[model samples]
Target: MIIVYHNPRCRKSRETLDLVQQSGETFEIIEYLKTPLDTSGLKALLNKLKMEPAALVRTGEALWKEKYRGKDLTDGQILAAMEAHPILMERPVVVKGDRAILGRPPEKVLELL
Candidate 1:
């Protein structure tokens, strides 16, 4: 099954979800903000995404800027920040089988479908 880490507040995430629905493919939505991921879950997602903890971060968020900007963080620290602040996690990550993609333009999710 396809899994979409979605955020209703994000326009791109909504668009991605709409596309997934239109494709007539099976998918599950995980609202990361509402159902936050722990470090281990985040690690699993990172493995699927083939990304480092820093790569999964929404660096432009206020939380990152106000607290983590310019800090020399290890992977563990970065993951800790994301675990503590789900808002720092990027939206609309689509996972299928062993692969995952960030649905930035929304259409990227089509690759998994």
Candidate 2:
């Protein structure tokens, strides 16, 4: 089963979800903004993403620039920031079995399928 961490307000996230639906594959959607991930959950997702915490952050977000910019923080601290502010988390992370991808271009999800 494929699982997509989605944010409906995000265009890329919506596009990724649309692509998954068009693929005609059964999948699960996690509306992460409404149901925020805790630190452990976020950490597990990072492991699935095969990336560090910073990699899963939307560094361009204003919250990131104002609050976290130039701050030397530990992995745990960064994860905590994402948990507290869901907007800091990158959108449309799709996972299939042990493999996952950040659907930045939306088409990247095709790799997992």
Candidate 3:
């Protein structure tokens, strides 16, 4: 089974979801904005993704630029920020088994298939 941490408002995320649907693979879509991940959950996701907390952050978001940019933050701090603001998280994180990847270009989800 594949799990997609999706943001419907994001074009890339929507595209990724479409691809997953077209592939006819069993998948679950998690709208993280409506139901945010807790710190531990985020940590687990990061482990699956083999990604640092900073790598999961959407640094281009205005909230990040205004509040978190230029700050030297620890991994915990970054995770806390993402929890507090789910919009800060990067979109279309696709997971299969223990592995996960960000679907920035949408096509990246194909790797899992």
Candidate 4:
């Protein structure tokens, strides 16, 4: 099944959700901001995404800039920060089984379908 880590406030996240719906596939949406992911879950997602904890972070976000930017943070520290502040995590991270993708441009989710 396809699972989308969605943030309804994000334009790209909304666009990606629309694309998934148009694809006529069953999918699950995780509004991670409302229901946050634990450290292990986030780590597993990072593994599926083939990314480091920092890579899954939205560094451009105000929280990141204010709290984490230009800081020498380890992967564990970043993961902890993400767990504590879900907004630091990027939006529309789509996953299908063992694979996952960051749907930055939105259309990238089509790759999984």
TM-score of each: 0.97, 0.96, 0.97, 0.97
> How much does candidate 1 score in TM-score?
0.97
Clashing pairs in 3: none
* Model 3, TM vs. native: 0.97
TM-score of 2: 0.96
Q: Least accurate stretch of 10 residues (summed lDDT) in model 2?
A: 40-49
RMSD of each: 0.7, 0.9, 0.7, 0.7
**Candidate 4 structure quality by residue, lDDT tens digits, 26-112:** 999999999999999999999999998988999999999998899999999999999999989998899999999999899999999
Candidates 2 and 4 compared: the better one by lDDT is 4
How many clashes in candidate 4?
A: 0
Cα-based lDDT for every prediction: 0.93, 0.93, 0.94, 0.94
Summed over model 2, clashes come to: 0
Residue pairs with colliding backbones in model 2 are none
Tens digit per residue, CA lDDT, model 3, 46-93: 999899999999999999999999999999999999999999999989
What lDDT does model 1 reach? 0.93
The regions of model 4 sitting more than 4 angstroms off are none
Report the number of clashing residue pairs per model.
0, 0, 0, 0
Evaluated at residue 67, the lDDT of candidate 2 is 97
